[model samples]
Target: MFRRTFWFTTGVATGVWATTKVNRKLKQLTPENLAVAAANKAIEAGGRLRDRAVDFALEVRDNMARREAELGDALGLNAPVDRALPPPRGYAVIENRNSPKYVEGPGQKSTYTTYPYNRNEDH
Candidate 1:
């Protein structure tokens, strides 16, 4: 009797353990879990691609600026290089009151008044 009871209990325990493991594995392999994992990997890849693109763009801009300076020196242009940032249209205080002010009508819920001042042409 003792031997039979022990064997029966061992069998029940083994069956329960196997069932729990199989259920857990099936849940992990479901379509919803797989899709979510794939989406996360895709998002990570996209972010990496964007960062690489931005870095490439910045490097290209720097190289172009350097090449332009070298060409200017070789050509012997005596004009002083100006790197000052121009003030934005709204923030710039126009000295000449007669300077032309171009009005842009409301388009797409945005209304803007722009001053058409040419930097090359001094007022």
Candidate 2:
């Protein structure tokens, strides 16, 4: 009787363990798990892109300052003179008469006819 009870308890414990292991494996193969993995990968990629952009901006700033200093030296000016120069300006919009017009062109006439047609009547 003692041996039978022990075997019964052991069998129950083994069955529970097997069931838990199968459930865990199935959960790992679920769509929700896959989506979570994909999202994590995307976030990692985005972080890398953000870091590269910051590095690129810093590089551009360093290069521009170096070039300005070189130009100042070649022009017989001191480094401090380059620092006194104003920051570069953005594009400017010019309003000139020769600019293209959105209106009708020369010698072109626009005619509008009424919805109801009356061939016998003249306007």
Candidate 3:
């Protein structure tokens, strides 16, 4: 009698646990939950793809620069030439069209002139 009672209790407990587990899974399988899960997975995949692309681009750029340097050395063009940066264009210069410096006389040509300016041409 005791053995039969123990088996009956164990069977009831197992059935209850299985039913709860199945119901929980069914709730998660709803359309709304499924869509959310799919979107989250897609976003994760996109992020990974973007990271890979950026890494690939950086690698390609680094290799290209190195190869160019090698080619420059072979061509005897690797010597460091004069590297000078131009003066910055300030807001004052850009806005001051009436300034004497900006006034384009026959001799003084504006840098933005459509035609080339030659000092020898005036002589």
- Candidate 3 lDDT tens digits, 10-115: 9999999999999999989999999999999999999999999999999999999999999999998998887899889865424356433344667765534333
Residue 39 CA error for candidate 1 (Å)?
0.9
Per-candidate Cα lDDT values, in order, are 0.80, 0.78, 0.82
TM-score of each: 0.47, 0.46, 0.61
Candidates ranked by lDDT = 3, 1, 2
Of 1 and 2, the candidate ahead on lDDT is 1
For all predictions, the C-alpha RMSD in Å is: 21.6, 22.0, 15.9
What is the clash count of model 2? 0
Scored by lDDT, model 2 comes in at 0.78
* Span of 10 residues, lowest total lDDT, candidate 3: 92-101
Q: Write the per-residue lDDT of candidate 2 for residues 22-97, one digit (tens) a residue.
A: 9999998899998998999999999999999999999999999999989989997863544476978997755333
Give the C-alpha miss distance for residue 91 in model 1, angstroms: 44
For candidate 2, give the lDDT of residue 110: 32
Stretches off by above 4 angstroms in model 1 are 1-21, 78-123
Q: Which runs of model 2 end up more than 4 angstroms from their true locations?
A: 1-14, 77-123
Pick the winner on TM-score between candidates 2 and 3.
3
